[model samples]
Target: MSKYESVYIARQDFSTAQVEALNEKLNETLVGLGATVAKTEYWGLRSLTYRVKKNRKGHYTLFQIDADKDAIAEYERQMRFNEDVLRQMTVKVDAFEEEQSAILRNRDERGSRGPRRSGPRQ
Candidate 1:
C-alpha cells in the first residue's frame, strides 16, 4: 500500500446539495476500493490562478488515502470520467508529514492571533 493525496476541483455551477452529494459519492468510492481514507478537506470555492474551462473559480476538495498503485489509478480514471469533477491530481507521499506541517503552521498562527469574534454591521 502507498500513501497518497488527491486534490480535485469541481464545476462552479453545482448547487450546494449537488456538491455535498458529490463528496459523499467520492468517499464511498474510495472506501469501496479498499483504501483507508485518512482525511478529507474542502478548501471551498476559490479563484483559479488561471481560468479553467472558462471558469474563474471552482470548489476544491482534498483527500488523503492509503491504497495500492492500481487503486490509485482506478480512482484517477473514475475522477476523469465524472462530469462533476473539473480536474483532479494524485500524488504519492512517503508518510503523513504534510499533516504535521499543517499542524505546525496552525500553531504558529494561533500564537500570533487571538480568537476571532463575529458581529453584525455597526
Candidate 2:
C-alpha cells in the first residue's frame, strides 16, 4: 500500500472535544475501508490566512496513513459531505517520516523558547 499525508481544518466554532470526535470518526471511516492510520495530530485552533466558509479560524488535524488510492478517495468523499470540515487535503508520499510532523515540531520549538521579553528593541 502507498503512504499518504492528510490534513483537514474543522470549523472554528467547534470545541476541542468536538474536533477530537470528528478525528475519531474519520479514523474509523478509514479503518472500515481497510486503511491503517499511522498517526493523528491535532494542531488546535489557528487563524487562517483568509476566511473560509465564513470562518476566520479553524481546528487543524493531520493523519498519516498507509492505504490504497480507493480508500483515500472514499475518505475524501466523506470529508466533502461533512459540513463541519472546512477544508481537507491528502497527498501521496513515497514514505512516511518516523518523527513528529513539522507543524507540531515548530509549535514545540516556539513553546520551549519561554516567555517573550517585554523590553523595547534597540
Please count the clashing residue pairs in each candidate, in the order shown. Answer: 0, 0
lDDT of each residue in 1-122, candidate 2, tens digit only: 89999999999999999999999999999999999999998999999999998999999999999999999999999999999999999999998889988888999999999889898999
Candidate 2's C-alpha runs over 4 A off are 119-122
Candidate 1 stretches with Cα past 4 Å from truth are 97-122
Q: Could you give candidate 1's per-residue lDDT for residues 6-107 as a string of tens digits?
A: 889999887667777898898899889988888877766878899888888888878889999988888899998997788899999987655534634675
Instruction: Identify the leading candidate in terms of TM-score.
Output: 2
Q: Which candidate leads the pack in lDDT?
A: 2
lDDT score for candidate 2 against the true structure: 0.95
- Provide the clash count, candidate 1: 0
Residue 93 error, candidate 1, Å? 0.5
**Per-prediction TM-score:** 0.77, 0.95
Model 2: colliding residue pairs: none
